[model samples]
Target chain A: MKSHDSHPHYWKVFATFAKNSLIRDMTFRTNFILQCVSSVGWTLMNVGFYLILFQYTDTIGADTGWDRDKFFLFLATTWFINSIVQAFFMPNAEEFSELIRTGGLDFALLKPIDTQFLISFRKVDWSSLSNFAAGLVIAAISLWNLSARETNPMVPSIYEVALYIVFVFLGIVIMYSLMICLSATSVWLGRNQTLYNFWFYITNFSRYPMEMYNRGWGKPLYGFFTFVVPVLLVVNVPARILAKPIDPRTPSEWLLVGWAFVAACTSLLISRWVFYRALASYRSASS
Target chain B: MLTAPTWMNWKLSSWIMIFRTALEERLVYRGDFALGTLMRFLPIVTQIFLWFAIFDAIESKGENPKGLIGGFQFEEIVAYYLLTMLGRAFSSMPGLASGIAKQIREGEIKKYLIQPIDLIGFLLLNRIAHKFAYYVIATGPFALVFFLCRNFFINGMPDLLVISAFAISLLMGFLIGFFLEAAIGMIGFWFLEVSSLLFVYMLFSFFLSGHMFPLTLLPDQIEAVVNFLPFKYLAYFPAAIFLEKIPPEDLPLELAVEAAWLVFFIVVCRLAYGRGVKRYSGFGG
Candidate 1:
């Protein structure tokens, strides 16, 4: 198999990967059931937290004119975006350092398909699909509640939804690239788990609306993290686009889009650079 | 059967051995140990700043909020959250149950069982040693930051006495939690998968323990129900003590309740261990 073949069918690779992952997951039915139950329990606990918070404070940021329903809808949307990332990106990122430790990357290197794509998409924890579905259902319910309460319902237009989807896709691409870059560092660090924890800790930024934070401090920091690193954009921008319609005339939305594109490009380039650099250090454990 | 004094001495020696092992193990991961401490500190700081921002916004709106959220002033809320943060740090025990489960699965615990050491004593010691270091390193800095950032004043020695009593309650709370976890770890002898059970316990601790939010913030009926639960003794009581909300005179009654729970958990652990050992096949061997 040619390692760098240009004519390789990527869809076929993905199909095989998906099928293998599904089979492996289905084999562990009891574990999957327990995980699903645990996910629902956690989601309910988290929602209860927000409900209690809103009980005391009517809006997260009252000055921003966001009410309880809007605040929760934003939280629900954030969870949805997070679930999407967890489903697609987190499993791969989590396994990277371990792969390096165990010399599992050699198998990927020997494959005809792109090593990066194979490593990132190889193991899909199908249980995360339940999380994603649950989050979307919760978001839909919250949005429905909001519409019922409002006299003139602020239902998001199709254009807004389309843009949001585009941003979410871009966000996932950037996130995957960032994970690849981070995982590539594992080749050098050699079994260090600190990076994974750091990634998880920083990802907590996406759990809430960025606007809830003081913008004076948050905006500049968000700009740096979102544009430069791109984790912040994963949920914040997508949630913003979905929660409210962006003014077409405003420079901010255009700047955000441009920034997201640049972030995606930069992440991919950096990941490629790191992966190639670390490839030299790869020594198989089998030897 | 061993005499009481001999058993006590044996337990003490085993505890020292466990502590020594943990310390050595912790030293091997010094960098991560430091980072974990810092990571643990960040959540508390973030929570404090978040509450500060909210209360600042509220006070600026010219409400004389004096009690708790529109009752007490913003300073009180800061103090409450700071104490809660400190309580959270002190109360958190490492999930050694899962670690033990893994050991059991891998046949690692069988070697330990052959040794003269008391397994429960060793496990509890390991927990206490790490917690001792963590509370001092993490909560010490947190308390310092909190005090430095605010003009906190105590009304009297009675409040200080209440806080001290709450500290004892906090210790008992940790004991209850540790024994409960030990009991759960023993369940590994029967069940191959206990992660879900552990997750349920964690969620219960986070919500019902008043770790994420104040117990008083819940509706009166809910607060009454929560008060009857053991989770409140873990965090809420300590926080109430620091805020001077719990009256100094009521300290003994609360301490008795905490002690009762500790005793109950100890009995449960003993029962679980007895039954668990009968079912224990030492599978890998």
Candidate 2:
């Protein structure tokens, strides 16, 4: 019954949700452990894949400036951002349409708390967060190796590290915005079976650096993802800020940082608008 | 319900009927199928960029490199990916295993027990029909993408032998993939939750089966290990056979090995289903 307008009440409710989620996870001890192990194993396999590719080439793309360690750092950031999104938001988006079809959202709407917050954080998939720990380990190792290297060392100052954290959070915000917007579409469609598949197809582009998308034919693709969908800014900016900080030597490079900030704000606003509009159009299912 | 026919001719006729019904079910949402298939091809865009950069880097070196890296010429690599798309079309079971596990968990599998049709055979025929429907509906998208990649066929059309080998491998790969997944789903008879297990199996299969990149790109020792594994028959072997990357002497042996794996998985699937069905309790009812 407590509203989310008050900051203290929101945090209190969130803490309870986290605690309940942890309890549920612990109730299935073996399943929890196996899920964690499986996730970590998958990450290790991905690392091995990149290691083999690095043997054949010095960088992911020609003259892209992303070397092995830096690229791993980028990959680690991807896992971290994606883990958070998946752990909290993905399951909820996947189930949103079911709630609508079954009239479960009516109960949610009756609650005094903010509807979006309740829907998004209601189910925390604790096992999905297992990849977050692996991401941290990979990020640490990549950072250590990058600093040890002779060529273009990338040791971040404390200020830069703080900026990195901020940008990473911004990246999560952008991704969450995208997800909720798609979930909102479930209201009109009545079913969103293809939402996750479409999401995966789109986000696959974010796995690689944006610079890789700047070639001849890639130019249009680069423009589309950067300006149209804006997924290109989600991971690349935060990864670059941490792994290979942009030099102030070029005005164009500075524009990229500015674009990241703009992207984050625009995505958040658009998603919020879409969610509310979808809710407004909702006609509760008959009992 | 009608009993299955004893005659060999009628047995084939019933399977054809099953296949046709399944194909009709898939075609019910033809637009969805076409759009979904096209969206999945979006990754090809990323691959083209990634490969182009790799080739550019290789070209930057002083040597001509003969259009080759990792035993695949640049055009050949693109051709290989196009072939892989076709191979995966046959072999990839997106949610088949999980769907089976869900049915077993929910006790819906009892319908299969009561039905006259063999569960494995029914599922296999249904999947064959689904793939047939997908292939027919998606041929336009496939052709469009392949047309873009036409230049990648540097050697023109391959010989009949290569094409035959490739087709055989893809068919065997589909059988292997199906049986392997159905066997995994049968694990649900013992463990109520096969989701995590399926996750592990899928993750390993995706990497080892050369879905992400060719196994040949791995180191020689690792590639040898992968070759010994059954996963390559699912994606890599068909593509390799089509490209004539496998030596002429090796073709028969590789195909034989692929067929052996198919038989192995078929046996495993039957054994698992046989044992699991006996222990399956109707939980919901």
Candidate 3:
């Protein structure tokens, strides 16, 4: 039965956005290609930097189970999560302040569709998706090497694979939630040009293994990020599910895994609340 | 109707005026820069942890506390990273190239051409003023961070000579950094958008400048090739000198080569500006 819905079809709206973004990207085809190449080069340099470091150590931390192949998988997971954030949300987030400054948000608010959805999906940086492709290549090579290096050619169980896929999606959602909350602050702050730099500082933590932050003063940091902000789980939990299975003895690790689900739901709620709250405070700049 | 001005005095006064205005302009726009300066060093926390783990693991294997990797003992490695950060703070030209590209693309270069001011000289003054503002704001944060990481400096303080050398290298590094980026930005005269080119330059520059790791950590052949390039002077050379890695005898030669690179870049930038201005057609203001 065709029900009369008052709201605009979000899927159709999204398809239009995708089409417009593709058109925009094609208009600067050379620039789009160059950006992809540049991104790939940077990723390759990161791989090289670690490859150099690995010459001195067996793993990222002292026997923390991030042997190079596993670490590459972790890096690949980071690339995947980061690429999604960059491709889908970063351009929009960066423009959020501009929209506020130019009173574009006022027009957006008047639209029938949801403001948050409109704000977040307004543009896509297709060039950033190259990092996702690069991540796939890295993940594939590392997985092959990992299997070849193992005595029994370790194959992940279906349960582990299912959990990994779910956790990765959750990780992306947590990142998006964090990004949206940050982006929403532009409504209050007026013109937030330094958002990119500040964003980098926060998310840089998630690029590495969480176990690397397990020692000394790092303990409290680990706790703060894991529980409070949950950036620690963005890449770690999902990658860990594939790289190394959680030992039943380590109840805390298991707890962290379970809490990630709770964190995802809570983060989404908090971000939505923050977004609307920010919107309520937003005085229209347009006359 | 005061009197006839001395050329040197007039130039000096104008320079001072430019610098003062630039300083005030920076202060006016400093919404997050003061805090951003401190936040920029947040990565030092990660560096400290990562180095400690690497050293600990290596030392455990041989039961030797002072095991060397790429000619850097554990403490020296930590100190090297810190010193490189200091050097980068001095030498990094954040928006010099892209800003220049924007000016060229939008035909804002006409302002420099029509005015009495020299473009490169004006920009140099602006950059110096920028560094001055940065240091004024960042000194407290830098002092606090360095004091906290004092344990990393296991080697006793360098003699006066090395400090002087480090200071000289930093000054030279600043000049080299400015001209190198300006030269790259001058390409905007020929190309409408130089971002892709700038991106490539930045990626290679960061990697080759030894910001990621010590130059010695690279294999011998790659190290030799990298040393042949001017980039190491920007970050690695200053830090290496501060760590007293250069022998006293080789220090003079190293400084000479750095000075040579500086001269080379200044020439290239000036030449590019001349050529660019010759063919330059002003577009939309």
Candidate 4:
């Protein structure tokens, strides 16, 4: 009898898959390098654009507690989360629709490993990780500048650092769950070419400081993205944790930090339910 | 007093037939493009929120917000961005350059070479048809959004002369966008994959063309240099003209320069395509 219970060597399997992906990438060495360079180039333009904007104002908004350096740190954290999503989840999410259209997901379901695990871990686009390295350089520089502030230098505490790490991981969980749900729509819709466009529209909300959305006409968008989609916490909580010291005066920021955990867990469960439900409805179009 | 080429002697009805077929094909995919166009406006909504916060901060700082940085008021900046979106819709060639590169790489240009129809002429007609179909579907959403945001226009309307000038630049911008992308595509004859180069080109065009922000927002030194470059005509110049950023005194000269750039691109693409076709060889049927 064939054994289909589980594979104990999931990590080993992932490593091998990653190794094969590297090999495939190396086959087009110039393309891989160009991809890295182009991504970095785009990031630099964004930084430059904001640099000019900073010349006009000391902060992104009035009394939002974000200075130039803090905003850079927040921007770097945005890059960190984005790089991880684009490197790992985005490629898989893009392929998920194609698999459904081609009936490849049926074969994926028959595998010995967990369908989600096998599906998500299959390919690793290392070129996308160049942005993560770029983010790290920016983050380290921002940290140094933050510490070197003459008057009110902000050095992160151990507790803050711990919270930052945990929140970053939880942020990834929330983003992954949202992406999986979007990809699951392809099973019903068939040939989901708009996946990337929708992803871009959704992530555009999370990229800026959440404070930017707290004002007049933006209030509706702030509520919708925060409560319904919960992307606001994806970068906000961790970036804020590093950029500022914990203040007992501000209960709302603390409330957000607490909510990230709840949001992650809820999204995880909702995504699991959605994925299987979509799978149950999936009818293979390819022979 | 110049006679057109022999290929131009083809019957008008045949040209009309080709144009109609391409238009119909594009119309079949109009729903998808219309949705894509509508989704694109989401960024502008975000821009509104962003700029409002920035200007609000400036307003709190107790300065006359009318003539702040880059010579733009809060209301004008929003209107400028809205206008640039329209300019981009006109000048964006989408997959034109890369599609040409792909055709050249895959030997699909063989069909064009073997046929009596000129490759450039055929592609231009097809693109015009495609654009027609897009504007047909996109006009509704664009009209609604522009109407809603009409209050952002501090200066309500311009005279007939300015309106005519703005319309002329937009048409020229479309032709310039086409020829510029086609010239880039001709590079496929020399390189197997120009998609990466195309990506890099797009990055620069997106930045330098003032699609991201007003060219005037750049430091004065950089703005002076950028004003002379052809890139501005792509997205910036038309919108700038419409916004009355260019004074009436300089309008005629600016239009002349824009016309010169359009002619320059047309020449460059024709020359490059000719040389590329000379070296192109198809291996199999």
Candidate 5:
């Protein structure tokens, strides 16, 4: 059999998807503008709420050491990570279920390429770039504010920046795997849009720092989200790397990375297994 | 001029018809109605948990943090947020009015116009129908859960009266919101895109109306300015009434202001509809 990686058809499929996205976006200039405004407006609203909270209270978590700027930095990083996930993975998950419902998946499956890849990257929402950019601006502002307020003047080392990037990529992979796992369930369930939405809703908890839930009932719940669901690793670990330097002698940071890696791999394996299982049960709605 | 008795009877019967149709429609879509209600309440649940965590942390610090912050007890804050959430549910019906206006601009209003009813009345009825269903299924259960969890009570009969007054104010608030959205929606006839305008309006509602947080919690200068705006009538006033933060004597005057705003928006909506319909070239017909 021909190697799948060497196939020119894979590149052709990606090009077609990119071209279609460009065409669709060009047709709706007003939507693009509205989307950009919506992203910035939502970010401002969220930040405003946090600022109000911080104004009244000095500490959020068990640690009184971290201030408002650090909190804002955590939030901004989460927003950036979330926007990227929404831009890529969320659309794919949404489209996957929609395609299954509408029988659009038949056309995709018939194509001489990997059905998963074709379904996942069929269209990228260009407007999500606006959110990504807005998040970057907010993160920069937060970092500047933190620098001014920091009791301990510490600069992020090159290794820390590189590690942050790696963790962010891993977070995205984990999130994508989760989405695929959910979407794969749709092959049998047919139109599990509510389940998808519920997943998104649960993920909203990660927008704030995991430290906020460091104790009490919140601790156990946060642990589930971090270790089991692993959404917190998407933002919390990356932001922590930049904001607080952990000693390399300590094994905690390494353990977190290893856990994230395992979770990502497990989710991907489960997704593939679920997809095959659902495929076995699948009878075309049209037929 | 019409006789008072005859006019009153006609108005009463028309309202009855609208109510009956709305009730029936609500019954037809109970599942979706329940889901919509859940969606509305989810954010409140998340927020309450967050506040609970914050209060617990404060108490652990061996300081009266709650007392120090603006004389509000932790329970009072929860009550305030609950009232705010209820006001949000009631006042947000205006979004449908805007959706109707969009349909009108797109010439889809003709379909409704062909029916033996006023389009505005029909749209209003649709909104009330959904809200009625929501109230019966969603709001009732949500209120019960909140009250049970908080175990708080109104002080006296006077406070109960104030709560009643607040309910009336919320209805008025919804009408004002509806009319304002209708007026804005009519602008779709002039502008092909109104989402940005709608978003700006939503931003104003979220901030100035104190939907996200109480105006009192905001900076003093910003609070003073926002209080004068009609946005506060939609959310803050009703919430304050429920919290018994607003005195019973003030209820009548506050409701009167809300009624006046409703009337102003109604007139503006009527004028916009008149002009917008005349300019309708039926591009989407």
Candidate 6:
């Protein structure tokens, strides 16, 4: 696969993997359908919870500009990014330890492919796409509502929309990097039982706007998550780009965007380094 | 009738033995418990920030700046979350449903069928032990956090009556949560996969139990609806008792309702297990 990488057939490889995943999902039709229902049900329930919350309050943050509709867009963006990550990488991370235990990693290593790509995209949870669809609908509806509001007409330009997509893509990359880093740790830990639990706890912070963490005690947390973990960038930057709750032309806003791009690149490099190091430490079961 | 006493004594002793063994097993992983508990508290950071943001947004510019939103002052809300964390420590069944489903899927559940052991009783005893160990191990972290946020409590520690009610609610919540999850797990005997159903149950419980936010923060109609649900007993009711959110006059009725829900779930769990056993098909050796 490395030898043929110059042929520019990456899309073909991804398509094959996706096809295989869809076929596997179809084999358990009822289970797949139920999973889809469950995912969508959870998303709707989340929306309902927020709806209830917003009934008593006008905005999530004071003057930070995450009003109800704009916050919905943020939540929708969270769902979108999280769904993609879960669909593509979460299941792989979950099974990483099992693969290690069974010497499946040895087989993977032998394959003529980029090990990271093979490991990350091995399983695609098609059912998670239900949440993706739900998120798109919610985001669209929220954007429409925000734009149509009489008080402030915050219709995003095409360039802003493009930047929003780019930031969202960067968010996915950062999330994927974090997941792969944890999954790689299975090489040393033998069995990382807390992988998903830790992931859930860490990513929980990212679901809310980063502005929420700009206050007194939260300022330290913001610094740590922004610099060390980089989770704050996952949802906030893209949501900010689309919502434009704060002036996008502001220096701080531009700084955040630049910082997010830097975080994405740094995280990818760090996780790749960790994966290779863990690989070096790995000993096959037979050995 | 004459042999009932001896049989009951024997069963009680066995359950005690099971509980002790489970407790011992749990203690072996105290380090993991402590770490996991501390990690779980990480979410409170986000919650604190989020609630602070909400209160800041709702701040009136002039007189009565201390106006309580959702019938809770900022400090009270923080205190409520601390109590809720303690409540969850008691009632949270992390893997109870899925564990049972896995056992059933693997045909290991046949061990209970063959033995005199009652599955639900065994599971309940194990969970009691698990919670016991968790509280013992996690108390330090809980204390540190609570001490740090001590000012959040409006009146500091509650009186004996409130504490007793809070304890009772937590116990009842544990039983309700266990039986509810066990009943869901029993569905695995009938269906090849119960994961989706379990997921739905978890989603509902997370919202309705006020694990995410105070039920009082919800709309009045929805709060009323949540009040009727057994889930509120899991995390919210115990915390509410600690906060004195429920009126003294209403305490007895609420406790009775919680007990009733526990009884209902217990019966459902038994029925499901019994019927499930009838349909059991063996799996891998």
TM-score of each: 0.88, 0.93, 0.95, 0.96, 0.88, 0.93
Judging by TM-score against the true structure, name the best candidate: 4
Q: B145-167 in candidate 2: lDDT tens per residue?
A: 88887888888888998888888
lDDT: worst 10-residue window of model 3 chain B: B1-10
lDDT of 4 at B3: 61
- In Å, residue B233's CA in model 1 sits off its true spot by 2.9
- For every model shown, the clashing-pair count is 7, 0, 0, 0, 0, 0
lDDT of 1: 0.70
lDDT of 2 at A162: 93
For residues B6-111, could you state the per-residue lDDT of candidate 3 as single tens digits? 7667778999999999899888756477778778887767776777777767776675556788888878887888888889988899999999999988778899
Per-residue lDDT over B20-53 for candidate 6, one digit per residue giving the tens place of the 0 to 100 score: 9999998997887788778878888777888787
- List candidate 3 stretches off by more than 4 Å: A1-4, A150-153, A245-249, B1-5, B63-65, B283-285
Alpha-carbon local distance difference test for all models: 0.70, 0.85, 0.86, 0.86, 0.72, 0.86
| Candidate with the greatest DockQ versus the true structure | 4
Q: Score the docking of each candidate (DockQ).
A: 0.45, 0.66, 0.66, 0.70, 0.38, 0.69
lDDT of 6 by residue, A189-218 (tens): 888767668989989989998878887877
Q: Give the chain B TM-score for each candidate.
A: 0.83, 0.93, 0.94, 0.95, 0.81, 0.92
**Stretches > 4 Å off in candidate 1:** A1-6, A215-220, A245-254, A280-287, B1-15, B45-82, B103-116, B133-159, B281-285
Q: How would you encode candidate 4's per-residue C-alpha lDDT over A247-267 as one tens digit per residue?
A: 443888888888888999999
RMSD of each: 3.5, 2.8, 2.6, 2.4, 3.6, 2.7
Q: Which lDDT value does model 6 have at B219? A: 76
Judging by DockQ, tell me the better candidate of 5 and 6.
6
Ranking by DockQ: 4, 6, 2, 3, 1, 5
